[model samples]
Target chain A: GESVGLHLPTLSVQEGDNSIINCAYSNSASDYFIWYKQESGKGPQFIIDIRSNMDKRQGQRVTVLLNKTVKHLSLQIAATQPGDSAVYFCAENKATDKLIFGTGTRLQVFP
Target chain B: SQTIHQWPATLVQPVGSPLSLECTVEGTSNPNLYWYRQAAGRGLQLLFYSIGIDQISSEVPQNLSASRPQDRQFILSSKKLLLSDSGFYLCAWSPILWGLRINTEAFFGHGTRLTVV
Candidate 1:
């Protein structure tokens, strides 16, 4: 079965530092990938996205790098803040426009 | 300018009770709407999706059903709620723009926290 998963289940970083989260996907046909942030009690918020044709994309303090060769994806956050603590999800959209999301990585930033 | 609205923000219903959660989009017409369920300690599972009015496609078979009555309104309903239905339900939509492309961006509304007691 085609699936997307994270390399770490949880990640902790100190405020003002940097955070890196990794994901690996199995579907080669999945042309679109997105990273979302979900706070404790809200829906997932769109962070950044990358198309299969592109290897990298950046937004604000975050950067998304796609390694199609290894089927790997990563999200890097600079100057991590307390507000950055949340569950992060990586989703892959297949040709049908259906998104398959990873289990999620819980990012805990300490002040 | 597109906004997705899903409510009630939270719900507590007993098992066997009927369920209805509504999601309406303002600023986008005939968008592709989707319903997803996030169970405790689990990932987001796609339940149903609709591309247009009265059109629906179910990916998972459960006690849930979805409907698109208008171009911008999508609804998820069930004859009876189950304990397994207690989870986070999110409504999302993609712009009804060009042809099918995996790179299309989708946005979500404040999810509905469902708790079946």
Candidate 2:
């Protein structure tokens, strides 16, 4: 079965440092990718999204990069903060309108 | 300005018990509704979606089913629940972006935590 996976189960970063989370997906037909932030015992929150037509998308303080050739997706946070600490998940939306999610990487920002 | 609501924030039910989780979307019309599940320390799994009223699509074959009785009301139900069905259920709605396909972002509710013993 086609699915998505993250490179790390957990990532620790300094409060003032930048953070990058990596994700790999096996579904080549996927055209849309999204990054979500989930806090403790809460539903996932939308962070940013990128389409196949473009390789990069930027939001307020977050950026999403897509490498179609490698089927890789990444989310970058500038000056990571304590509030940025959460479980990050990369989701791929196939042509069928179904989203398959990656395991997730827990981002821990040290104060 | 859209909001998604999922109710019975937490539940404790025994195996083989019937289950029903409600999700309602407000401030949006004809939005795409979705149901997702997340196990302990796992990722969000897509369970069902509805593009319109009375339209439902199931992604996995399981003891669960979905219904869209109204335009923005989606329901997840199970005739008999299993122990493995215990998890967090989330409902989301993707607003119409430019009146095109599903190219917009999704708004998620707080979520329903189910514990099936």
Candidate 3:
């Protein structure tokens, strides 16, 4: 079965540094992708999204990069803060209006 | 400015008990509703999605079921709960394009924590 997956289960970084989370998807038909930030005991919050047409989209301090050729997606966060520590997930939009999610990567920002 | 509301922030039920979790969307009409489950230290699993009233799709087979009674309300239910069903459940809504397609991104609610023992 086609699936979406992340490269790391946990990523540790220092405050004020840039953090990158990577994802790999197997479905070529997916046209849209999203990154979500989930805190403990809360729902996932929308961070950024990118369509297949464009390779990169930037928002605030977050950037989403999509490479259709390699079926890869990434989220880059600048100036990582303590509040930015959360589980990040990459989602692929399937044809049925469903968002297939990856296993998630726990981002730990330490001072 | 659409917001999603899911009830019962936390719940504890015994095995074989009935369950009902409700979600509603405000400030948006004809939005696509979805139910997703996330286990501890895991990613999200899509359980159900609804484009409109009575139009729901289940992604995987399980002891749970979902319904869209109204345009803005989505409900997840189970006749008998299983220990494996314990997890954090989230409700989300997305804009509908031309009443047939869904938008790129989805907004999510706070979520419900279910514990079945």
Candidate 4:
């Protein structure tokens, strides 16, 4: 069975520091990957996505890096803020149009 | 612009009781709809998906089932519920862009929290 997983269950960072979250997926056939931010009592919000053809993609203040050979993916957040505290999930897009999600890493930003 | 709506924000049900959760999408036609369940401290698990009206594909085997009566309406139902079925349920939609290419970015609804007592 193919699955996606995170390297850490929780990550803490200083408000002004940079944050990095890591993920590993087992499905080699996946063609697309996405990162989502989920706040309490809310649905997962799409932050950024990268296609298999590309190794890295950048958004407003976030970036997604993918390593196909290692089956690894990572999300980087610059200048972490208190508002960035939430659960982050990485997902892989399967051929069936379904997404396989990782358990998620809770990002805690301290002042 | 597309939006997804899922309701009753919260629900409580007893064992062996029937359950029904509804999800609807607006402002998009012929979009792909999906149902996902997220347990505490876990990731979202894909339960079902529909590409068109009355066309559904189930990912995992369980006591639950899903249906798409209309292009924008999807329903998750169970004849009898189990305590393990209690979790946060979400509905999402992604538009099909450029022929059969499915959009990688999916929009999600608020979500429904189910507590089986």
Candidate 5:
């Protein structure tokens, strides 16, 4: 069975510091990966995504890096702010097939 | 812009009670709909997905069932509820072009908090 998992269950970071969250997936056939942020009592919000073909993709203040060799995915948030505190999840799927989600990593920002 | 709507932000039900959660999408046609359940401090578990009206696929076998009555309407229902059914239920929608699914991210609703007591 294929599974997606996070390396850390909880992460604490000082405000203005860079935050990195790591995820490992077992499905090599999955070609699409996405990262989501979920606040308390809210639905998960899309943060960024990277295809298997690309090694890295950057958004406003976030970057997603994928390493197909190790089946690893990571999300980097620059100058992390207090509002960046939330649970982050990484999901993977084959094209448009069902997306498989990993246990979320809770990012806590301390001022 | 497309938006997903889910109702009953919070629900409290007893054992053996009937349950129904509704979700709908606006501003999109023939979108792919999905129902996901997240337990407290857990990841999202996909329960059901629909590619079109009356077309559905269930990922897990449980006491609950899902139906797409209309193009934009998706419903999760159960004739009798159990304690294990309590969780945060989320409805999501994604774009489907020419019968092919796209890479566009799925948009999730606010989610319904179900507490079966």
Candidate 6:
């Protein structure tokens, strides 16, 4: 069975520091990947996405790196802020357009 | 320019009561709809997905069911709610690309918190 999972359950970071979240997926056929941020009592919000064709993609203050050989995915957040505190999840887009999500890593930013 | 809307930000129902959560998409047509549940400290569990009206796919076998009566309307229902069904329900939508049913990115609604007491 194919599954996506996170490397850490929780992460703590100081303000202005960089944060890295890791994810590993088992489905080699997956073509697209996305990162979502979910705040308390809210639905997961789309942050950024990268296709399998590209190794890396950059957004406003975020970046997503995909390693096809290792079947690994990572999200990097620059200048962590209090507002950035939330749970981050990595998802893989299957051929059917169904996204399989990881357990998620809670990102805590301390001021 | 598309948005998803889900109602009843919070809910509390008896264990045996019935449940119905509604989700609709605007600014798009013929989008793919999905239902997902998130338990405390867990990941998103996909429940059901629909590519078109009356066409649905169930990812998990449970007490829950979903329907797509209209192109942009999706509903999650259950005849008898269970304690295990209490969780955060999220509705998402994605545009279908031409010639293929694949979607680029999914957009989610605010979500509904259902607590079966």
Each model's DockQ score? 0.68, 0.67, 0.77, 0.75, 0.76, 0.75
- Which pairs in model 4 have colliding backbones? none
lDDT measured at residue A75 in model 6 versus the true structure, 0 to 100: 97
Q: What's model 6's lDDT at A52? A: 90
lDDT of 2 by residue, A53-92 (tens): 9999999889999999999999999999999999999988
How much lDDT does candidate 5 score?
0.94
Better of 1 and 3 by DockQ: 3
Which 10 consecutive residues of model 1 chain B have the lowest summed lDDT?
Answer: B96-105
For each candidate in turn, the TM-score is: 0.95, 0.94, 0.97, 0.97, 0.97, 0.97
lDDT of 4 by residue, B29-113 (tens): 8988999999987889999988899999999999999999999999999999999999999999988887685548788999999
User: Considering summed lDDT, which 10 consecutive residues are worst modelled in model 4 chain B?
Assistant: B97-106
Please list the residue runs of candidate 2 whose C-alpha ends up more than 4 Å from where it truly belongs after superposition: none
lDDT of 2 at A66: 95
TM-score of chain B of each: 0.94, 0.96, 0.95, 0.96, 0.96, 0.96
Chain A fold similarity by TM-score, each prediction: 0.98, 0.98, 0.98, 0.98, 0.97, 0.98
Q: In terms of docking quality, how is candidate 6 classified?
A: medium
Candidate 6, which segments miss by more than 4 Å at Cα?
A: none
**Residue pairs that clash (backbone atoms under 3 angstroms), model 1:** none
The digit string of per-residue lDDT tens for model 5 on B23-104 reads 9999989998899999999999999988899999999999999999899999999999999999999999888877778666
Q: Which stretches of candidate 4 lie over 4 Å from their true place?
A: none
| Winning model by lDDT | 5
Residue-wise C-alpha lDDT for candidate 5, range A22-98, written one tens digit per residue: 99999898889999999999999999999888999999899999999999999999999999999999998766557
Model 5 vs. true fold: TM: 0.97
Query: Which of 1 and 4 is ahead in lDDT?
Result: 4
User: What fraction of the correct interface contacts does each predicted structure contain?
Assistant: 0.65, 0.57, 0.74, 0.70, 0.67, 0.70
Candidate 3 C-alpha lDDT tens digits along B10-109: 9999999999999999998888889999988998999999888999999999999999999999999999999999999999998976766854788899
